[model samples]
Target chain A: MKIISSPLELKEYLKGENNSIGFQGSKSIGFVPTMGALHQGHISLIKKAKEQNELVVVSIFLNPTQFLKGEDLDKYPKKDEADKKICKLSGVDVLFFPHVEDIYGTDEVTLSAPNVRGYVLEGNSRPSHFNGVLTVVMKLLNIVTPTRAYFGKKDAQQLNLISLMVKQLFMNTQIVPVDTVRESDGLALSSRNVYLSSKERVEALKVSSSLRAASSMVGKNILDSKEIVKEMRKSLGDLEIFYVEVLNLDFEQLLHVEIGNTIILVEVRVGTTRLLDNIWL
Target chain B: MKIISSPLELKEYLKGENNSIGFQGSKSIGFVPTMGALHQGHISLIKKAKEQNELVVVSIFLNPTQFLKGEDLDKYPKKDEADKKICKLSGVDVLFFPHVEDIYGTDEVTLSAPNVRGYVLEGNSRPSHFNGVLTVVMKLLNIVTPTRAYFGKKDAQQLNLISLMVKQLFMNTQIVPVDTVRESDGLALSSRNVYLSSKERVEALKVSSSLRAASSMVGKNILDSKEIVKEMRKSLGDLEIFYVEVLNLDFEQLLHVEIGNTIILVEVRVGTTRLLDNIWL
Candidate 1:
């Protein structure tokens, strides 16, 4: 496994890999980009990448630009030694560990998330958040030049926007959304979950629990969007619910629960830690 | 030579070409993107592309986004049949002619030019102009995926911004800056030159003439930037000079003309039609 810090070095290495002999299949690459503090969620994304491609490249870059002015940027977890161990064990072919200076310049051309779609949900709370997310993603995808990029549905809105970016920009890579990884008690695995206290961890479960109830309501022949959201609001039990939405795959509001197409998304604050979870039907 | 209006078809064709075995030397593509009304300047660009690469792809797209509201987008000249003939004559392998609808969507992730560089010079008069230019360029570059794309130094700021975009975005394609093509009378060739009436056409020569005088000053070892600019203003004879200054390749202002590194750029209006010209030393 190679650990490359420079973008140019990665490009050179990838170029050689593309041209060199002895690779299986059509010399395809699967990339999984993440912020550090790798948990079960990141591991699952890497696992899916390894299963599908001749080479798997994982990037662990805690981008500073994505966090808002008062967000938990400095407080974001950093478990580098543990992350390295995870990658080595998980059989990652390349690990892109770029410094902040290496990734950004004083003046640069950046990606802007679409006006309407980008400003709802996660974007509504944190404006210019998706713009930062997309700018970094665009850079990483170009640097890696992956044949397929893995994105967990845990960040469903991000995944959808990335998919839109890929389609709209006509990028070479394919975006494959892996399922959300979860804890035994149904809490979605997130690095931020570490910020949760014992009591807060238990409270975080309400997020997934609400999503699960929405899923169950759909299973019990509850097709109306309003009915499910109303029940989800009750299931959440008012633990500082930011939003509980029933959206189509396009992230548009839907009146009817279209099975195989609807996503039940929930975001809630337990104490001070914010948790997001969603269920794709 | 083939004329492809659909981006998907062009991609498929390019893919086949990449895999095919009959090309001489390493299969490289040189691309020249343009709006129609082909002129000597465009022909010069095509000629350079033909000299360097095995395959040359030319795109003639009259992009609406780049023009500000009521900024001659509707009045912009179009010479479809003549442009096609010129492409065929210039030995272009593929001519990508796409309509506006095929290139844009309702909701899209777009490119934003850097604040300082993009919003100065041309961007100052027309805000968000470079954003549209960059967005379309990003789309076209991704769709064509050329080995090396070509741009004339006639639009030095645009070329600089495009180069910046490709570098910052980590795009695979190289931006090759071709020299500005000029008329025998020293007027820089442009599609908008057709909008110049007989008297205005003669007045437009002042733009190039001012740059020429500045170049002569540098030849005579008169290297002070302000001195050169002062003399240039006198040469221009106050024909509505928008901007005339000395700068380095990075587009930052230079106090003294650094031989082999200086650029004298001028933007002037001739009877309501703006013309830009620059001489790189």
Candidate 2:
């Protein structure tokens, strides 16, 4: 795998790749952007990209703007050497490792999240978070111009909003949502999982367990969103709950769950670490 | 020239054009986005695009968001047939004529202008104006993906803000600024010019004449921005002057003029019609 640190160099390399293949036979590029601490979740996204496209480009940059003022930005995990090895093993053609300075500028043109949709649930807790996510994603999309981009469904709101942005802005990339990769015990894999202590790790299982409970209730013919949420809250008893939302695919709140189009999302604090998980029904 | 009302068709056409030429030899698409009351000013921008690019695309979208309540959105000029003919005569390769429904959607992603820079000049008077301009321009740029997009220096503040957006976003297209087109008597061309009565038209000359007076003062070694603006205001004289200010290219208020990087801008109302003009030094 070729590791490119410069955005311009990566852009030129992609341009050359496109030119060499010619128009009729141009190779499709699949991109997976991550804030670098690779786990099975990221690898799953990369492997899916590898399957779909002739060339796979993965970007690893710890974006500062996405983190709120007192958030885990400073202590966020960084495994650059390990990430490189994982990309190589996963058949990533290019590992784009850009610095924050390369990705952002002073008083830059920014993307704002939808007033109604963007300020709920995760956005409600961390208000300006999705704005940063949308802005950086836009910058990366422009730089990569990928044929398709893969995102984990664990970040359901992010995925939904990104898809909306692509449609609204007429961006050409296809946003593919990969299912959440979890532990054998059901804890969703997250970079922030590294921050959890052994006790906190045990507590984190409740998040996915609650999602599983919701899934089970749906399977047994309980479709009312309020009932499912009530059961989920019971399963997540005494945990620091941020929000337990049952939303449609468009992120709109649903009174009753619609199978195949509903997402049961949860955000809970495992000690001081925040972990998010979702189950799409 | 092919007239495409649907954005999807225009996108497909551009994609086919790219594919036919291949990447290395891909034709450069110069874009000119307008509100569609074509005159010599719009033609000048198109001609400049034609000179710089292999293909030129012109979009006629009277963006409703850019107009404030009680503004001329309902009565905004529309000459679709004449605009189409003008585009063909100007050798435009494609003319994108999209309806508001085709261009916007509910709860869509939006672009915001810089807090300090955006809320002055045009934005100050019509507070949310530049946000609308930036949002629509971003949409148009994404839809067109032009090699170079042309704008007239007649809307200097708009031009500056757009350029800032392109640079800050790291957008691929080049923003080419064309000089303002004017009549023999020195009234800068605008679509709003139609709103001016014959007498109002004569009164509007003060905008350009005031700019010329500022230029003469600068030529005579008067570099103080305040002094130049004072002279400009005197020339403009009580014709419902909106704003008379001298600022650097970045739109920051300049204490003194710096030749080659200054703009003296003016906005005045002739009867009920508001007109804007500027001089880039």
Candidate 3:
């Protein structure tokens, strides 16, 4: 797989070399953007992308603007060689590994997240985080111009906001959300998972378990949102809970969990690292 | 010209009917976005578009968001039939006339103008104006997906900010800066010119004349910015002048007018109507 760093080169490369890898059919590029250290979650996203299109492109950009000042941006895992190997093994057509300076400039024309949906849950905890996320995602989508971009349901809010951006901006590409990847123990896989210590690692399981409880509650016909949230908060058992919200597809607070339209989310601090997990019913 | 009101219909129309009006070869689209009172200024843009590309699209959207709360949004000139005739006469392939509802939504994902460049001159006077302009322009650009988009230099700051946005966002379309078209009497053509009474119409000549005086001074090697600004202000002669300053192409204030790299901008109120005129040195 060819790795390109420049935005212009990637745009032109995406345009002119449509059917380069001998998978010739109706031309399409499925894109998966990540902040490197490809985990099972990223691989799962890549797998969905590969299945859907003639070509798959993965981007590994450590977008700086998405992190808050105290957030561990510098310490975010970067398995560069391993990421490249993963891309190769997954049959990625091209890898976009851009530098911070290359992607951003001074006095940028940035994006603002939606006022209502953007201010709740993840956006609430890490304010300006979604703005950075959206700006970088927009830049990446413009650069890639893929037929379909794959986003995992693990970052449900990010995925939702991105889909909204594409719809609101009238962008042509489709945003396909893949199911969240989880470990055998039910902990959602994340790049930040590497930051957890042994004891913290065990504690992180609470996040997934709570989300699982929400799913189980929904399965057993416990439709009231207040009851689900109450039980989810109870399941955490003294962890640093940021929030446990039962929201609709639009991210609005829900009184009752409407099956097939509900997303139950959890953000809790396991040691110094924050863990996020969710169940989309 | 086929006029389309829906954004989806327009995108599909622009894509599928590239060669419908019977101009062939490489399939380039030149777009000119306007606010519906098509005068010589818009005709000039359409003329440029026709010369350059195989197809031409003109959007006549009087964007409500760009107008401030007390501004003349309701009273803005709307010569719908005349504008349609102008596009048909000018050989425009399509005319996009989207409604506010079709173009914008609740708590939308929007484009913010750059902090420094976007907060001066017109942006200063009408705060959040450029943000609205950029957001609508971004929506239109995405919807149309033109090969090259045209803007008038009469709205010099608007042109600069749009170019900056396209560059900063890594957008693919080329932004062509069309020279401002003017009347034989030297009044810059504007749809808002309709608001001027017979007396204010004559008084409005002072705006362009101020820009001309600055230009003539620069031509004679009077390059000092302060001196040029002083003379321009004198030329305005106690009218309701908003700002009379010389700045570089980057919109940063300049100590000296560096010939090809300078712009002299002026905004003044004549009666109850605001007029803007500028000269690119």
Candidate 4:
């Protein structure tokens, strides 16, 4: 697998590959952008990307802009060598690892999240987080020019907002949402999971259990959002809940759950590490 | 020339053309986006676009977001039939004329101009104006996907901001600055020029003349920005000067003019109609 650090070089390399293929024989490129410290979730996304296209490109950029001042940007995990090995084993055609400076500059033009939709749920806890996610994603998308981009559904709101951006901006790439990869104990896999202590790791299971409870309530036709949220809170007992929300596919708050269009999202602090989990019903 | 109002249809049309040509045989597309009260200035941009690319697309969208509340959005000039004829005559391949609703939606993802660069001079007078301009331009650029996009230097700040956006966002389109087109008597062509009465029209000459005076001063090796600006203001006597300042190419205020990298910009109100002109030296 070819590893490129500069966006310009990566673009030039891709352009040359495209030119060599000729227009009629063009190949579809599938891309998976990540913040490194790869987990089962990221590998799942990469595997799905490899299945969908002739070539798969993975970008590992711990974009600083997405992290708020107090967020653990400085301590965010990095496993560069392991990530490279995983990319090679997963059959990635290219690995794009760009520096913070290469991806951002002074007085840059930025993408603002939709005021109403962008500031709810995860955005509520971490304001300006989605803006950073979107800005970096846009930069990556422009550089990669992929036929399809893969995003894990574990970050339901991020995935939703990204899909919205692609549609709203008329960007020329398909955003495919892969299902949330989970642990045997039902906890959603996250890079932040590494931050959890042994005791906190056990408590993190409450996040997934809460979603499972919400899913069971939906199965029993308890479609009212308030009742599901009430039961979800009970399942997540003693965990410091950030929020438990029932929203539509578009991220609009719902009065009641509508199957196949509703998402029951939960975020909780297990020790100092905040964990998120959701069920798309 | 084909005139398309739907962005989707235009995108599909372009995609079909791209596919038909095959990648290796693909032709370059040059684009000119405008607020459609097509005049000689718009024609010049179109003519330049035609000379550069095999396909030329001109979008006539009178974006309302750029206009502050109580501004002349409702009364902005519209000469649809004449504009169409002029485009056809100028050898434009496609004219994308989309409505406000076609381009915007509820709680949309937006582009914010850089705080320092965006809120000075023209931006100072029309706060949130560049945000709207950048947002729409981004949408149009994505929709058109042109190899090169053309902008006249008459709105030097706007052109500069647009170019900055393309670079900062890592957008693929090349932004080409065509020299500002002028009337026989040196009045810069603008759709707003129609708002000026016969008397105000003559007074508007001061706008361009101020830039010309600044240029002549630069030619004589008078690089002192303050001295040039003072004389330019004197030439404008009683014309309600908005801002008469010199700045570097990046729009940062300069203590003294640096030749080959300076822009002298002026804005003034003539009978309730705002006029702006600038020179890039």
Candidate 5:
């Protein structure tokens, strides 16, 4: 696998392989963006891209802008050597390990999340986070010029907003959302999962388990959104619950549950680390 | 030349082109966006693009979002068929004539202009105008994915904002500012010129001539910006002067004129129709 560091180098490298990646047969490109501490979750996304395209480009950018001042940006996991090994093992054609300057410049233009949609759920707690996520994603997409970009559903709202941006901006790239990869212990995989203390990691299971409990309630036909949220909150009793919303796939509040259209989401703090999990019914 | 009337159709066509037009070599895409009723100014932009790129695309969209509620959106000049004939004559490969629905959607994600830079001069008069202009230009640039986009310097503030958008947003396209195309009598060609009576059109010469006088002042080494504005205002004696200011290329106020680094801009009302003119020193 070829590892490219700078945007100019990546653009030059991708331009030569442009003809064999995506839909236009010879001139399409497939992109997969990750936050670097690659685990099975990122590997799963890479595997999907490898199956679908002739060339698969993966980006490992620990974006500083996405993390608020007091957030875990400084402590965010960085397994660069291990991450490179995984990319090579997973058949990633090129690994883009960009420096901070490679992605952001001084006096840069930025993206703003929609007022209503961007400030709900995850956005509610981490306000400017999505804007930073989107701005970097847009920069990466433009630089890569991918025909299909892979995003894991683990960051469900991030995936949704990126999809919305591509559609709204008329960006000529397809956003293929891969299913969230989870650990055998039912924990939805996250790069931030490393932040959990040993006991907190066990406690973090409640986030995913509560989501599973909500799914079971829907299976039993007790689909009242209020009742489901109430029950899930009860199940996640000791953990600090941020929200337990049973929203439609579009993140709109649902008065009545629609079987294939609903997402029961949970956000809770295990120790000091916040964890998120959801089930799309 | 193929004319695509709807944004959906244009998107479908773009999807087929994939990364070929933009990521591949030789054929560069040059774009010129206008609010129809194409005059020599718009024609000059198209002509310049034709010289620079292998494929030129011109979009005729009288974007409604740019006009305030009390402004003349209903009276915005639009001659679709004639615009098509002009594109055909100018060697435009594609004439994208998208309707409002093609560019904007219900409850859309949009681009906001810079708070400080956007809300000065024209933005001060039409408070939300630059917001609309930036939002639509973002949409158009994404849709066209042009190598270079053209704008006339007559709308100098608008040109500045668009260039800022491209740079700040990390957009790859270049913004080419063509000099203002003028008529034999020196009136800067504008579609809005249709609103002017013959006598008002003659009087509008004061807008450009004022800038000419300002240029003469600067040429003679009169360094004070205040003196330049005062003389330019005097040249437009009876016309309603909106603003006449000397500023550097970055739009920062200049205390003293510096050749090749200054732009003297003027705006005036000639019998109720507004006209803008500027000279880059």
Candidate 6:
């Protein structure tokens, strides 16, 4: 596996890979972009891409723009040498490790969100967060030039926005959304999950538990959104409930359950670390 | 030359192009995205791309989102067959002709500008215009993964935004900014120029002339921005003056001309069509 640090260098290397070999007599590229601190969740995305494409490239960068001023950006995990080792183990063909200056410049053109969609749940707490995420994603998509790209559904809203961007912009790559990988304790995996204290770790399960509880209630035909939130808040007692939204897949509020189209999302403060999770029905 | 009318068809064709023996190592894709009515200016852009890349693709799409509600969208030029002929004559390899439905869907994700940079100049008049431009450009860039994309400097602000999007988004293709093509009479060529009456045509030259006059003053070391605009408005009398700004290349208004870095732009109404021109010093 090659560790490519600069965007330009990775692009040049990818270009060579694209030109040198043929994909079943034609050449095609696959890409997976991550924020470093790799786990089984990221490897899952890469493994699938490797199975399908002539070439596979993964990017590992801890984007500062995505984290709000008080968020875990400063304390976020960094395991560069270990990450390279993991990439090699996971069969990643190319690794893109770009610096801050390589990804952004002064007086840049930025991406903003729809006023309605961008200011709910996670976006509400960190107002400018999605803008940063979308901007960086757009940049990465352009740099990789993948025939298909992989994204985990752990960040459901982000996956939705990326799909929306690809559709709206007529981006040619296929966005393959993989299911969220979770721990044995039913905790959804995240790099930020490390910030949780042992006590906070126990409290954080309230997020996934509430989502599961909501799923059971919908199965029992109790579909009212307000009723669902009421039950969720009770289960999440003592934890600061940011929001427990039952939104349609589009993130629009739904008064009743719409199976396969609803997402029950939860966010709460477990110590100083904010944890987010959702169940897409 | 092949005329691809739907996104599905184009995607399928591109996929085939991606995986076929004859496709690999055969060509570089050059792209020209336009709003249908192929004038000399657009032809110049297409011609330039043709010269640079082995396979040229031209898209004639009068993107609806880019036009404000009260703008001339209904009356926007549509020379479809003529545009096809123009591309054919210019040696374009493919003509991507997608309808509105082919490109946009409901509840689409949008690309927004930086709050400060996006709300000035043409964006001020058509508040949602740049977002629309950026969104469509993102789509088009994805749809036609050209080795290089061609744009005109006549829409200087649009070119600036596209360049910014390409850079900020880490898109792999290079942005080839073709110089603003002009009429022999010194009027900058524009598809909208057709909307102008003969009288308005003569008046429209004021935009270019004012930029020319401002450039000469900046050449002679007259650095005051206010004085430059004041002189420009005088030369462009009887037109509804929208704004006359002397700013840097980044679109920030300069208090004084910065020798090699200033751009004096003028926006004024020649009849109903708003014309813009600038001198990049």
True contacts kept of each: 0.72, 0.66, 0.66, 0.77, 0.35, 0.65
What digit string (tens of lDDT, one per residue) describes model 4 on residues B149-213? 99999898899999999988889999999888899898988999999999999999988888888
| Rank order (by DockQ, best first) | 4, 2, 1, 3, 6, 5
Per-model DockQ: 0.60, 0.61, 0.55, 0.73, 0.39, 0.49
Off by over 4 Å in 3: A19-26, B18-26
> Could you tell me how far off, in angstroms, the CA of residue B73 lies in candidate 1 after the best superposition?
0.9
DockQ of 5: 0.39
Residue A211, candidate 2: C-alpha displacement in angstroms = 1.4
Tell me model 1's lDDT, rounded to 2 decimals: 0.91
How far does residue B175 in candidate 3 sit from its true spot (Å)?
0.5
User: Which model scores highest in TM-score?
Assistant: 4
How well is each residue in B1-281 modelled by candidate 5, as lDDT tens digits? 98998776775665555545554443578999988899888888999999998778899888998999988899887688888899899888888988788787665566777767888788888888988898889889988888999999989999998998776666779999999888887788888899999888789888888888887887788989998888888889889877888889988899999888988888888887888888899
Off by over 4 Å in 5: A19-27, B12-27, B197-203, B238-242
TM-score of each: 0.98, 0.96, 0.97, 0.98, 0.91, 0.87
Candidate 1 vs candidate 4: the DockQ winner is: 4
B84-155: candidate 3 lDDT, tens digit per residue: 998999999898988889998899999999989999999999989998999999999999888999999999
**Lowest summed lDDT window (length 10), candidate 4 chain A:** A18-27
lDDT per residue, candidate 2, B44-77, as tens digits? 9999999999999999999998999999999989
* Residue-wise C-alpha lDDT for candidate 1, range A211-275, written one tens digit per residue: 88888888899999999999988988869988889999999999989989988888888888888
Name the candidate, 4 or 6, with the larger DockQ value.
4
Off by over 4 Å in 6: A22-30, A214-231, A252-262, B14-23, B88-91, B115-117, B211-234, B244-264, B279-281
Best by DockQ: 4
What is the lDDT for B89 in model 2? 96
Candidate 2: fraction of native contacts reproduced = 0.66
lDDT of 4 by residue, A1-281 (tens): 99999999999998888778765756789999999999888898899998989889999999999999988999999899999999999899999999988998898889999999999888998999999999999999999999999999889999999998999888899999999988898878899989998888888888888888888878888889999999999989999999999999988889999888998899888888889888899
| Model 3 docking category | medium
lDDT: the better of candidates 3 and 6: 3
